[model samples]
Target: MASDSLHSTVHQQPSPNLTSFPIILKFEEVVYKVKPDHRGLCRGRSSWSSTEKTILNGITGMVFPGSIKRRTGFVAQDDVLYPHLTVSETLIFTALLRLPNSLTNNDKIAHAERVITELGLTRCRNSIVGGALIRGISGGEKKRVSIGQEMLINPSLLLLDEPTSGLDSTTAQRILTTIKGVARGGRTVVTTIHQPSSRLYHMFDKVVVLSEGRCIYNGPASAAMEYFSSIGFSTSITLNPADFLLDLANGIAPDPEHASEQSEGLEQERKLTREALISAYDKNIAPKLKLEISNSRMDIYSFNKHASSRNDPTKAEQWCTSWWYQFKVLLQRGLKERRYEAFNRLRIFQVISVAFLGGLLWWHTPESHIQDRVALLFFFSVFWGFYPLYNAVFTFPQERRMLIKERSSGMYRLSSYFMARTIGDLPLELALPTAFVFIIYWMGGLKPHPVTFILSLLVVLYSVLVSQSLGLAFGAILMEIKQATTLASVTTLVFLIAGGYYVQQIPPFIAWLKYLSYSYYCYKLLLGVQYDEEDYYECSNGVLCRVEDFGPIKSMGLNQLWVDVLMMALMLVGYRLVAYLALRRVR
Candidate 1:
């Protein structure tokens, strides 16, 4: 078989610098299990019960780092890059947020560029690392970028979970080759692979095969087939070495053509079980492997102690960068990432169309038409009320995975990230609302005084902030899009109904509920801005009636304008505080 010849010719040797700094990762008799919920009839008993399921039973192995320090890097199966960011921007941002503050920004950027070149991503470095919806880099290029993100830290021990899982055979080979180069540079790379091709399998210096939560083989890749063959299981056909090992681990015997000379026991050998293979391994291999591990412990301990005493220049601080630095980097990244969504062409068109339509509907309304003017003001409040709410509701749910991944790596503090998101969204969230109010207030012929216009604008903007904070709170608390959106819909509907414009005299029992709605306060404040206590308009009989005496205005007059502002301010701060606390409790 090709695998046989390749295994004999291929040998992996560590770099000559290995002797200077060795890092040995050793784990012994590791066992892991999980409790599964079984909520059905089991063994003819109609009862619910929980049972322990074993995933790894007494597994033991070690990954030998040739000459490396004590840093570790991990890559998950799914690549979690921002779809809007180019490859160069992605790595540069990661470097800025994660690299030590001792290094200047230019130095960190240069390091990211070096990683780009090393990963062969220069061609696509300027391309966006797109997602399922966005089209940018290819699968291979994205996988390489994921690896480069981890490599920025210069980790001595790299752990990857199924790095080549969804790639083609050729692309998978290239990934493994890159990993091999990393190993050759005196670092240790450990990865989990299933059913690799013959050539790919031969590249590994060591192989650890497991079946049914137990280690079946742990030794040099070149010696695996030989070790299995010694136990009366040799393949007669030319098969991939990985395939042959899988067949044995599955308890399927070799072909009849390669059976033992004893014909009487042929059938028994063909039906070999996992227990028999495990027994053979225990008897023949366990003793020598255990002895080697025991002997190496002392050497590994002494080396680690000596290395810790030296002043290693590459060692990073516990937090890597200061809190303010993290905030600035995260703020810049958030703004760049959300710019498109905030100023989307479709959204801008929709807002402009609504503004023009509202302006034309109530164009040049007169002061005598008090009800018409009040309705226009209330519409303003309602539009801004829900516009920012729906947009802000999706903020945290969409970024849940990315946030968890980055935070797990200790890249930044929750405070820094939260503050950046809050501040970065200010201009984007407030822009369209400001435009809407300016257009409609003048067209609808509300109070012509400059002070009234400015106050009205401020109230509308304040209401927008309060509404957005509520949405953010819902999103952070639930972290599920469907649930958060549904809750937001119900809450906004309730607030709209309780708002003074729709029902000036709410039932006494539900009157207290109006106080809980920011919409009610915003509507009252808008009315106070456009009218005064002594302002009057011609009544139906040509008699003068005080504008504040109008039904909607009378119910909520300018007398409590300051109180309404205070309430709106409290809601703004209170909702955001709730959102922050909810985010802290996540994961």
Candidate 2:
């Protein structure tokens, strides 16, 4: 019926309207299609391993028209967000991703206004999205915003799972009423539901009931009660449809050997009612009707399949290409986001503090060598290992959520997000640390050997890269921010101990740990550079000792520093690889 109307120029005929409501999607074979044999409805008997066997098979009937369209809205449970973003910016971001070139200024503004008004979030249009406002926005309002986001592109079929799952009763009813009103305009909506009250259950245009893996029924929502009555069952006046259906399906597990006469009679009546349902819909179609519906359905579904596969600006077609694009775009965006987050904050603090700290220790000659070395030790400890901890805290959690959400839509590869993040941090890594090192080297006059100073800067740059990648790997291993933070902190703490920061060298007992310390390589290079060029004669107990006897052991040590840099580089590459694997698991 929908297909013929689409190919024609005249008004597409509306489907056969139910005295109640027309079907938007059908599964005549959705629930209760499978008979109980040894395998039963879910297949392969009732065992843990076989539990998921017949999941998709039990769904029976659904009906919807080609012209009907639907969209989804969401309200999260305890939302996390960028509080500074205006409501318009949030919706426009979705628009940019979805409608980009198609949406003009007025079009974007008009669309946003419509959403704000419809969702009743207009009064707070310019207000921040987080903090007290998190609870201020009603569940229904946020749900509508989420739906508006999905609706922007004009979807033909919308599947909303647990749309009102976390809302209060009044809010849940409002959401359902909104969904029904949208459906009345000839849109197709399919949703997974649970624990619906009588009013909530009655609001659905259709229902698809799934038990364990098997679907027991799929048809008009109103017809559900009638179908049960026809099978010699009764619903309570105040009965919840979802609960009643769940309890009934639970009884399907009763053993044939132990079944009472009443149970057997009810089973027989269930079979009869199933037959009656098929006959009434004319779905147990006569030979003639089967051919008619087949031609119409074949034509309709072909277009649906085609339409579904084609890529939109937002709904990417290929995971790799989309990820690559997401990488490029996010790289640019993240670099900017990170510049504000890391550079302006850390760079300011590190550069100013390091210059002043180095200046206070600037006049140190070979006589106070131990004091100078101790100061440098604080520099390495406070700066190198700790910075990664902060980077992990701020960046990883947000990116992890973004990565998970993107994967849910089934586009963008994990490797690409990981790779982009690794590459994107480079510009910031180079800029901020370079600024700090360059400023301190000039201010402190520690090394006139410009090459050594530059090499030291590059070494720190490489270490930052390794740290960022390592943080990402840890985040992937632990999904939640708090858990990931605890692990990242613990792991980093362990690595820092092994780093030669506090202890000059790893203990003999943990001798094997020396091989893994990124701190060892980074410190080795920096300490070698400081010792090499800044020659000193130690006055231990006021006894002066000539150190030039060590010859160009200074220059020789600089050559060995390359080994540390190479080790750091390998770590940079290696940690990113592990991070990619972990992120794939997250997806």
Candidate 3:
């Protein structure tokens, strides 16, 4: 019931900086469940089973605010940030999307700067928030940057999940102290800390200890040890209260069964202590919260009435900016990030090496060996098909977390992001294939006429586009790089087999599969472009031999060339459409 009030307040907030009465966050019988394990499958059954595990068991508690605003912010356990963006850029972007439109760019920038100062990130304001592949700010600074993003929204209620995780004791203490300072400024700060030091544990105003999805204690932090001791769990004055409480909650306690005993007695003692603690909370705390729920509803009635009319305009659920604005920002960010990829030495080397090797292998063969030319054309088709697809398969999965976070934040529409990324990647996608073809075409001794050469390049480029689109779809659907890669490889191999190359016979049932394979169309189109009109190939003994009028393209027919081109174009559009739809369903 209290969460309903909190939800309404959050949606009806007028602006980032606006403040009303202090808000309360209460969860009554709130439970979160998942399908047994992360994989959503029954472990030991042949048939599918519908079983669930509760992560938070009927969690009922209150996060009563000491501040006058329901601007609740959540900082996730892991930092979700763009590796390329500078600290200033990251904060400014978040502010632009979250702060009211009435605030000018200058105002947003000022707000972001203020957050930087408040979070002690001023020294690293311009530094990149780098990730595993890149080096930038230290871990503490990155955590502060995560906090600064939320700070830009000026939230009065902050919930952080292990904000100090993976940090050194000093850094963790510093971060906790900063959080304590924030709490002292009249904000309600709740965090789920793990294995905190004694100094760190003592900093909290209140601590809610949970065990196996049940609340074992919900009271003042200073009084936790006393309460546990009162319930028959021994404590040392020298022992860290936080550690003692955790050990008591987890079934780890001092036992007399030392050297060779089974310690079943210790296990029984722990089970009893756990049950006792659970019963203690149910008897002591839940009744008070239940009583408060009714009383607070009556007290906040007048405040709710006054706030409703003032907050309605912002409650309509519109995006921060126009679709066009979102598209422009996303496109700009995509292009800036791709600039680093365009200069990747390894990719450049791979493309050049493959092109040169293909050229050397197929160098200047006379027209007599028509199959050699066909092989060269097929090689081009298969290479472009596999290469771009391979590259695209990693795109979404690599950026999945970032996309989900930003999209969830209402930063932009999925359509805006999808379109911007597709458009932004066009140049790099087109450049590599064109260059590869250029180097190999003249050296391999294919038709040199301008129209034919241009046609060949366009066909190959379109093939690359189709491959890349499929890759995007794979990445979005799989959401894991390794899985997507494996699936893409298998699918590409199937397409390659059905690509009208190695198979001399096709089963009637699967004959139509060639239409689904872009490689098939690409190869056909390339052969038609290069050798459709050529009539002869030189004999092995150096004499010219008579060949068919239409060369190797005779079997497929010249009309099918246009059909292949049309199909390649269709596949380009179809794959991208599928990719977009897959992305839309990701979360």
**TM per candidate:** 0.89, 0.67, 0.87
Model 2 lDDT, residue 167, Cα: 89
| C-alpha lDDT values of all predictions | 0.81, 0.56, 0.76
Q: Summarize candidate 3's per-residue lDDT along 1-587 as a digit string, tens digits.
A: 01111222221223344443355666787788777534555677545437777787867777766232225677888999888888988888777666666677677778787777777888888888888989989898888888877666666678788898999999998898777666655556778888788998888777788877788877778888777777666644478777787786786653434322457866777777678878888887778867877677765676567767575434645765677867887887777666767658898889989999999999986676677887898899999999989989988998888887777666678888898988888888898889999999999998889999999998899888889999998888888999999999898999989877777367889898877889988988887777544456675676665444334455444455667778788888888898898889876
Candidate with maximal lDDT: 1
The regions of model 2 sitting more than 4 angstroms off are: 1-57, 63-84, 100-114, 131-136, 184-186, 197-199, 210-217, 235-297, 301-367, 371-375, 378-383, 393-401, 410-458, 477-494, 497-515, 540-556
Error of 3 at 266 (Å): 1.1
lDDT of 1 by residue, 6-106 (tens): 11121233122212243566778889998766556457763544567888888777667623322566778888889999999999999898777667898
Global CA lDDT of candidate 3, please? Answer: 0.76
For model 3, the stretches where C-alpha displacement exceeds 4 angstroms are: 1-22, 31-55, 66-72, 229-236, 251-262, 504-509, 531-551
Clashes of each: 0, 26, 3
* Candidate 2, RMSD to the unseen true structure: 8.7
Model 2: weakest 10-residue lDDT segment is 1-10
Candidate number with the higher lDDT (1 or 3): 1
Q: How high a TM-score does candidate 3 get?
A: 0.87
